[model samples]
Target: MRTHGWRGQPPSDADEARARILTATRTRLSEAGTTSTSEVAELIGVTRQTVYRYFPTTGDLLNAAAADAVIGLEAQLIKHVVEHLARTGGDAADAAVEIVAYVYEHLRDDPALNRLMAPGRISSTVAGLTTPSAIALGRDWLAHFPVDWEAVGLVGEAQAEFVEHLLRTLQSFVVDPGEPARSGAELRAYLQRWLAPALRR
Candidate 1:
């Protein structure tokens, strides 16, 4: 019967409880660079049992938080690309390079994303991106861009392939970053030269 999930105020429903837990998780991650069910429960004035009822494990909690964070961040990235292309008069290829570079740079520095994408946790990250949910998210986001996929002969299954390729490339860079890491202008230039051409097709 214990309902309070935050301080003295209880969430109105299960959905609200889950939201509060996620919010607490994000806050804890920002402050401590990590979080635990116990810490989240303490922050929310809930029992560890309550947290476990919602998220069975720390990984589950982290994955959910990371997914939420990525959705927001990706939207922002898309917005940035749209605005940048509009101002600069860049084509779809330019947008592709920009998007890849932006994600590569930001993902490296994103603490929550880094936690979800840690070495042993890569399969989880891969599955998240390759699953139907991820594909739908990617497709929806890309559809908003000014890119003329049809003109480039990148419609239907080709479009899906392009999205998956972009994600896989980003994941590769995030995980290994290669023997000689590229950064700053160098990385941008590399993505422009390589990734841009593929998108143009």
Candidate 2:
């Protein structure tokens, strides 16, 4: 195999290379506001091609690096959703809107989560959010809801599909966010009008 100035000796195997790329990516994200493929490559003494070989794209690299941060964001989101459910008697659709609105209203206050909501390359960002791990994490977040998903007709595949839908909704809010992003009462009302119907069906 060939190498591209990756320290004294290049990674001995593909696994090490991928790990190094992830490490480099996390480091780059910390030092710079964004994680660029070329920056990760240079930081780790490898060529951009090497980084791409492991990560496929900058979005993939960024998503990989931010996976841990995702969990933290989920924790806060889950807490807020659960609390909302407790206060409001846990309607499934309303809980869904709560998750979306909570992030919209508060994502900026938390630096880590604020950064995560910034959106990325459409393909990779969607791919990243829909990965098995991400999906499972979504389910985990939902599982904490005080409502009975089964009683609401969201069991088995229905529940899993709901998780995916929620992810897409979150993506849209953070990405395009309409001409002006909706939050607080306006956002909640908008979600109740449009998003809640989908959940009820």
Candidate 3:
């Protein structure tokens, strides 16, 4: 028989509570990195023990915070792409370019996110953000993308892989600014050149 491993499914109530607490904690951390447990508990309308029940340690809270931020970020990207596509005659390739440009323009100035994912104390966030929860967020985001993946010569899995790689590559740029510098427009151009061929499939 196969072992369950240590990955037992959480009860639904506990899972919902954990998700709520993590959501609050992420907002606190993104807005203010050195958040207190008391503050987060208060924000979530829960007692400290309730918070502890979900995340037993400050490190755990921080880990959840990172994952939460990634979810939020991906949601925003998906929203933008959806809106853009609707307004622009439903062109997926155009939406893709806009999405990449949006990331290039906004990612650098996002302070809380920068500290959370940068090569500093919170690089652990990267691992958390790349987890299944975060990956699902990305998949959901791209699923609504206005592109015809199959017509573009990419199957569903390959399309998701392409968007995932693009996001991760852009994340690296956000985390490591000194690696190279370019204007937002220039970076957008670069991504278009690199991604366009694969997108065309």
Candidate 1, superposed: residue stretches over 4 Å from native: 127-136, 199-201
Clashes of each: 0, 0, 0
Give residue 49's lDDT in candidate 3 (0 to 100).
72
Residue pairs in collision within model 2: none
- Best of the two (2, 3) by lDDT: 2
TM-score of candidate 3 to 2 decimals: 0.63
Better of 2 and 3 by TM-score: 3
Q: Write the per-residue lDDT of candidate 1 for residues 1-201, one digit (tens) a residue.
A: 459546778888889888888888988988888889899989889889999888999889988888777876888898998998999899878877777788777677666777766888877776666676676777787888888878887788888887888787777787678678886688878888888887564
Better of 1 and 3 by lDDT: 1
Question: What TM-score does prediction 1 earn?
Answer: 0.82
lDDT of 3 at 81: 80
| Candidate No. with top lDDT | 1
lDDT of 3 by residue, 1-201 (tens): 111211243225766667767766767866775577788877766567767766888767766665565566677777888887788675556666777677655545543354464556546654554566665665666667767667775566676676677667656665555446877677767767875556654
Q: How much is the lDDT of residue 106 in candidate 2?
A: 53
The 0-to-1 C-alpha lDDT of every candidate, in the order given, reads 0.81, 0.73, 0.64
